[model samples]
Target: MKRITSFILLLTLIIAMVFPAPFAFAAVTQSAPTTEVPTTEVVTTEVPTTEVPTTAAPTTEAATTEVATTEVPTTEANTTEAATTEAPMMTTAAPGTTNPDTVTILHTNDMHGRLDAEDGRVIGMAKLKTIKDNVQPTLMFDSGDAFQGLPLSNFSKGADMAKAMNAVGYDAMTVGNHEFDFGYAMAMQYKQLLNFPIISSNVYKDGKSVFAPSTIIEKNGKKFGVIGVTTPETATKTHPNNILGVTFLDPVASVTAEMKKLQGQVDAFIILSHLGIDSTTKLEWRGDNLMNNLASNKDFLNNAIIVLDGHSHSVIENGQLKNTALLAQTGTALANIGKVTFDLQGKNATNITASMIKEADTKDVTQDEAVKAIVETAKANFGKATSEVVFHNPVPLQGERSDVRTRETNLGNAIADAMEAYSETGFDTAGDFAVTNGGGIRASIDGNKDVTVGDIIKVLPFGNTITQIQVKGTDVVAMFEHALSAPTIEKDGQVGLDANGAFLHISKSIKVHYDLTKPAGERVYAIEVLNKQTNKFEPLQLDKTYKVVTNDFLAVGGDGYTMLGGPREEGPSLDTVVRNYFKAADMTAYQSTELQRILAGTASENVPGEVTTETPTTEAPTVEATTETPTTEAPTDEATTETPTTEAPTDEATMVEDTIETVTTEQPTSIQDTPAASVEVKHDNVIPFDQAVKQKDKSQHDAKAQTDKETAHQLPITGEAAGTGAAAIGLFGLGLYLIKRKSA
Candidate 1:
């Protein structure tokens, strides 16, 4: 009998060695981010190898990839490392979806006062409230800078936004630089109108935090300690005057203090932060900086489970932190709503996951009636201003920060033209040349579309007034030098723009030729001012004082134009000047100019230069991160802004995909597709969608590698886990063999 049993056991061992159990192969998959996705379309994959199971596992019914859609960071200095930390963001189940123990946190950051839907791009506040309602046991919050962009929100000085937010049911919020755009007092009024707390732990006045540093929110039998902190750049990000009474204190000190106080009282700590992930931000002010700074404290990392980030308008759908905590951010404007879920194992919050719910995902969600009424009311009041047609544009007006800051775009041309023409109407005297800072042009206007007063304001949101300054030709040269001083890179064929808020855009009446290849201060080889008297170009005289028209920001030496100091004469705001410019019958339509104002050489004359192949490549507009957070020099908004830009609301759908493609090209295919993936798995079971359906396909790998270079983008699973997971299959098989032998 013993001999027979040994023979059977040996046979079993041989079988195990030849065909490993699928469970054994599944060990490595255990570390898959425990995030819970909503009901998502599933693509079934089958393992072709005979030894492995050919049957495809059903994709989780109620879960999606909990898809991250974490757009690649386009800001020159930032990387996915800042957002992803060491792992993909995780959650155990969908927020408010069938998980009784889970508490959902619905949040938005850098909404920038987008109250109405922009075609299908922005779902508007009503739809946002629907998302909030779909997820039960939920609490909502806005990180900061919510009500400052659109006319509907700003018309009542954010009171409209407050009413809308109240209709949607927000639990708490933090202050952002733009929150102070109206004034500190207005921000306080906004708080008063809010049904919930507006916490800003680090902002101070009279030696005390002006707002509560943190608040306790109770839901689903769980107590959450929510701590809020604003960016230190707030000191000057708003009109330096708006924040005069309030001081932005040390965030690190303020946050750590809150952590100590809230340790044992709450189930978890949620850091409501406006400090963006801008790489250009100072070490002390960057959100990533504050995250690392918190690690020094003993147990702070343990309790802080998630951070809902803003200020850079980054599209970090879901990301992990070094301390194993999670972080999430929705791109700016009401483009996406963020959902966070904490799965409770009794009273302890265990599995935490984050996901971004785009409008497409919420097609079935009904708009909240209350929020819709509030939004409609605000729009009805501002309808004439926002909806009235100013003029139709023949072509796209490129005012993308990455574009305007780096080159002389058509939008820049129109702005400068407006400032120069202001002399005929608003200006008391005629001006010779007009200059507008690249940073002041906040948005892009779609071509062949009806432009409106709201559209103009969207492009020039800063409310900078038109002003005149007498700049000597030598000072003009110096100011241009300052504009070109920001460091830049050359890519494709054109010199890629180094994003700078101070970059100058000269009017059509002036021409400055310089070589980007030349060193900083010595780049200009020639300078010419359009001789208004002769209607011709003439060499700029170093000592001659030229009547220069510019925005008040530059006139006040904002964006570091120290040479701009001169006698000032203020006129209407820049937006009004542009509005009047567009209203002109001759301005019925405008087109993108080839090399407006600034040029690499004289060849790019007023006649319009031919676009290089590389220039068209740069035309792939920076999405999400495109809207600058309107900070001091850092310009945070999950971007380098992704400072916001939209040519048409319909174009937004395609651009959303472009934003993904733009981000994915920066990521490699090999890392995203792990070898263990040789065994077919669903995206819901593993990482993001992968090109490699069958890991053994070398031809596919080669083709995918080349494809990823152009447009296909992907995200990688935890590399260390992937490598170990593959090895676990073999080890698991061997363990079965050993166990069978011992039993025999």
Candidate 2:
């Protein structure tokens, strides 16, 4: 009887061991609330703005490679459906079958409408599709600046961009400043056209958000709260007319409010941000500033896994910003794709990682045919506009930022010559010589390279149209003075290259010599206009009225060229004029290929032949665009990565207890070492606005944004629990043997 009773007791103990002890259940009950986040709406409006379920209200906290080359079926009736139909990427996770804890994020930014598979260095949408399709359980996102740089996408008013993204199966995207380039209504129309979510937390109109503020996505059974935020620069960086009714609040304040709104519902936080990381931005609106402020505050990381950023077009290496490894910015033009994986469980995530895939590493990736078809169709509709060679360049023309902004280059000569050549053709206003801001030209025409409309578009991406305006000769001299007024520095030790956006380029028909030793606004000592009949240089008449061919941007006082205008007489687009000029010139470059036009008193390399200045001079051969010009390789702009400077927030908007889930971290003294060395990367296509409507003042961000910091009592890890149960079962077997032997 005693032995039987002992066996029964051992059986009861073994059964109890199969499950957690009652005290363990009590511990789980204590932590259950932390895991069961309430389901709440996040405010997605109708139409483009979806109305997400509103949360409980203010609180704190927060693919296997396969290039699907499947060709499209040729049934005309099924063509549109096949192209527009979007099958979600490998993202669905069965609760019982798969590891519901892990998910991947695939992202791109600053694509700037580089949708073509063959354009420039852009990997194109099709290749990106190949790269994206390889990973399973992934969500695709674009940080912004996706729709307005190239002609093909812009020609469709952003529809091509939407189509391509749709075919590629994007899950979500943040609004980039360039999204408003076509105008606000068109931007919203584009939003309505897309198959995924477009969100921005700070963009509000009439006291309501213009688009959705946040979206909740389910990946591998884990709920990810994706909060979208665009840079406040959008208020001024784009056409002011487009965002007239929209108001952008402080980013920190918005983030805090949203965190409070989503207190306990999400498993992780993702900031799909267009806020760039750059020093050019003031302290308040910077990513690095905000991250530095919150580096020690894990709660303020607000449970955020990563910040996929854009706008500065900078590449942040190692996915670290201000020692906070949760931030990343892939440089502009889809050069790299970013990835982040999360082994998320409640608020305790020990396995989270972020990385980027470079273009050079994409050789093994293959394209998705449907996406390829859409992109190729967009290009086909645009015609050989980007790929077909417009003209075969015999010699390289220098339109490099350093040369164009500082001194005369053969490429600048070609542009000015094109202006003059265009002026000579039939037009309402005529005469005199042509002058354009060196800033107008963006890139160089590589010698021996086949020039395409795409290349020209890249050189003059802005859609500024040309117009002839009249100004007095004295004013022209003053303009030239302003153009040459920037102080010269020794090229050897300068921290930054001297860049003058307003540096003027003159036609071959005009010559102006400058004295660098003179004061600003008084540099030009002589000016001469070409006499067509005599092909000779003559002194300019100070009182003479000279008609000039220049772009409308300058005529409207853009780039500070306000001194040269009258009634604007519009002509062909600047690009169209250049195209026309190219066709007629038969690839002819300017005869004044040297510094013959503007004799800057530099090294005795090109001494002025016509001007009798005390400056020693040698004349360069008057060579037109020839097949054998000297080779000059302009240094390319490296991928820039900047961690923006930010100031601490005035309010402790995101404060919580410093529990075990959080850790104290020492802040880095300087963030300079975080990103690549500083370099100026020009963002073109911005519409000029009145000076009063610049970027907003100041910023705010909290390091302790998440409200809940309750440290739950320790619970067994799954593996630990399994091991404990296994050990208990082994002991139970031993007890059964002992009891059976004793009873026998």
Candidate 1 displacement at residue 420 in angstroms: 0.8
The 0-to-1 C-alpha lDDT of every candidate, in the order given, reads: 0.58, 0.56
lDDT of 2: 0.56
| Cα-based TM-score, every candidate | 0.64, 0.58
lDDT of 1: 0.58
Best by lDDT: 1
Per-residue lDDT tens digits of candidate 1, residues 110-169? 776777766566778888877766565366888998877654566666678888888887
Report how far off residue 189 is in candidate 2 (Å).
Answer: 1.6
Cα misplacement distance, residue 272 of candidate 2 (Å): 2.3
How far is 744's C-alpha from truth in model 2 (Å)?
A: 99
